[model samples]
Target: MEAVVSLDARGQILLPKEVREKAGLRPGDKLAVITHVHGEEVAYIMLIPARKLAESLRQFLGPLLRELLGPEESEGQGGAGPG
Candidate 1:
């Protein structure tokens, strides 16, 4: 999907409705912009939701913590490992 938007005087660009809908972005939602370098070629832009990223991190780190600290550790530590 491609979208073209103009930056306002305040240096804010409004995302197109279609692009926002496709990306599941909504008003007041947080976005993380990622830029990639490719040997001086065209850079890549990635937009990710902050909440989604946090959720993904939690999901991935849960089992890793369990493996390192044992499954019972979470229970013994007052469920602080992942909640």
Candidate 2:
């Protein structure tokens, strides 16, 4: 699917409703933009669902924290909580 979206003066692009619905994107959903550059210019951009990125990051980094701090400390109860 292709969408021709325009950026406003504030640099925000409104995603067409059809596009959003097709992608299963809803209000408050977070997206991550990845830019591919060739030399001096950006060649293309890709949008990734942020939750997907977080899950991927957690899979890679979560174990390292457990190894560094030990299992008990890795548990939330032994770690810092929101103040």
Q: Each candidate: what lDDT? A: 0.79, 0.82
List the candidate 2 regions with Cα displacement exceeding 4 Å.
Answer: 59-83
> What's model 2's TM-score?
0.64
Residue range 25-78, candidate 1, lDDT tens digits: 889999988789899975877778999988887778777777788878855753
lDDT of 2 by residue, 1-83 (tens): 48888889999899999888988899999999999999999999888889888888777877787788876777773443334
Every model: Cα RMSD to truth: 3.6, 5.1
lDDT of 1 at 11: 85
lDDT of 1 at 2: 90
Per-model TM values vs. the true structure: 0.68, 0.64
State the local distance difference test value for candidate 1: 0.79
Quick one: best lDDT, which candidate? 2
